[model samples]
Target: MDELRAQLIATARAMGSAGLNKGTAGNLSVRAAAGFLITPTGMDYASLECADIPWMSLEGEARGRRRPSSEWRFHRDIYAARPEVGAVLHAHSPFAVSLACLRREIPPFHYMIARFGGTTVRCGAYALFGTQALSDAALAALEGRSACLLANHGMLVAGRDLKQALDLGIELESLCEQYWRACQLGEPVLLSAAEMAEVLEHFRHYGQQSGQQSGGKTS
Candidate 1:
């Protein structure tokens, strides 16, 4: 458990180093025995210690030296709703936030769109941060998907573990940037549903056949 806590802290700091987040504008968590361990709200990731991370129950009780991230509601909800998810990451990344501000659902303009387990990444309905409404909206947008944009806010990604979750977050933000840049040129050409379906099928078996983690391949 202590080791997991330390890894969570390292991952949180890595988010900033990877440019997926800055300041305390993101939160990360990994499933735990009692519940889940989450990064504390509004703290510098650089200074975090294992004990500073909070263990939050599915019912919302938090334990540890620090308070849980304000977005812990969605983390708890995702764990409760998605049995396969072992980690959740939310970030106010630049490109993702830019698209979220437009409330745009990313279309299948690229084959990587299927990497998220769907043809499009839905923009969740807008709600105040830290509210149950936000969690509900996110869950709806994330149906059958590993990631989604929070309308007017940022993005959320879930994975089988911390590494995968962080990788997805990075990939999602990169896609958002590509989409944004392409849109600046013109309405980007979008792939048809059948095209994305084919891509999704390919992704299902794209990675190595071993238990080794593949950064860009999920599920």
Candidate 2:
């Protein structure tokens, strides 16, 4: 619990340092034994302490002094559905917000788009924040992907761990910014479906053989 709390706090501060968030505009959570440990609502990250974090159950009860983030619903829902997702990061990064505000899904303008699990990054339908409706939209958008843009909101990404989640969010923001810049000049040339399919195959096995290569036990 102590280590996880520290990591959650560090992740929050890291988001601010990376300019992926401002004020308390974003939230993060990691899957825990009970349910998950999430950032508290309406509190400045700078003033946050380990004790300030809230442990929320899958059924939505929070067991802590501070209330969970209003967006905790989606985090809880994601954990319930995706067992591999150890951590989730949501941020109001500038580029991602700009694209999301337009309510558009990002196509495969770059090869790295496959990192999120498909040829495009979905944009969830806009719904009121903290509502089950918004969670539903987010879940639909993330059906086969690990990252998505919350329409008129921002970015939500999941990863095997907190570090990976933070990394994915940063990379997604970078891609969004790059795509935004391309739009300034003209339509960005996107990769073809077949080309993306080919790339996706390569990505599938790229990281899976690491243990084998290191002569470590695979199971």
Candidate 3:
């Protein structure tokens, strides 16, 4: 899995460089048959390497050189709860954290928010790190959606793969920034539930079409 490890390190660094995280304030994980590879605790993304990554079992036992990120519990719980999730990303992006601290949900202010497949992006209640309570809350908040903001902390996003997870993280942070800016102008204009449902349906069909095109090209 050296290639996967290398990709993880590179993607983590890219996320940080893109301002999706600061210092060592983010963690990333990708599913593996035995368990998963995750970022190490207290390691800066800019200098991360494949050797610095840690492996943890689905049961949360450490299996590699370094201790996994303190949010290992969060990642483990997510993987356990959602078998379809092949990658997880947690980041303390500025706008998302700001909204989380304010205890506000990311409303459906734009069609891009439809990627979440819900009326609004939920926020899990604050719980201490590495605790089962936080993991449980996060799972609940993420229901019917690919991502959720962690109250007073950051965000948790899951995807079918690492690239998709990274994309979701970026989209979430961008939506948060837009919401914040719109609020500054006046009362933010939010899409109604029916409108959001229509948007979500469109997204679902679009995804199907794209998948078909990709399959056709590969074949």
Best-fitting candidate, measured by TM-score?
1
Q: What tens digits encode model 1's per-residue C-alpha lDDT throughout 1-219?
A: 999999999899889988999888889999999599999999989989888998999999999889999999999999999988999999999999999999999999999988898999999999999999999999999999999999999999999899989999999999999999999999999999888878988887676677866544443
Q: List per-prediction Cα lDDT, in the order shown.
A: 0.92, 0.91, 0.85
Candidate 3 per-residue lDDT over residues 162-208, each given as its tens digit: 99889889989999999999999999777888987788766765545
In model 1, where is the ten-residue run with the lowest total lDDT?
Answer: 210-219
Candidate 1 vs candidate 3, lDDT winner: 1
lDDT per residue (tens digit) for residues 1-219 in model 2: 968998999999999999999998999999998699999999889999999998988999899989999999999999999888889999999999999999999999998998899999999999999999999999999998999999999999988889988999999999999999999999999999999999888777545655555321110
Model 2 vs. true fold: TM? 0.95
Residue-level lDDT for 63 in candidate 2? 93
* Model 2: ten consecutive residues of lowest lDDT: 210-219
> After superposition, which runs of candidate 2 have C-alpha atoms over 4 Å from their true positions?
207-219
- TM-scores of the candidates in the order shown: 0.95, 0.95, 0.93
- Give candidate 1's whole-model lDDT: 0.92
- Models ranked on TM-score: 1, 2, 3
Clash number for each model: 0, 0, 0
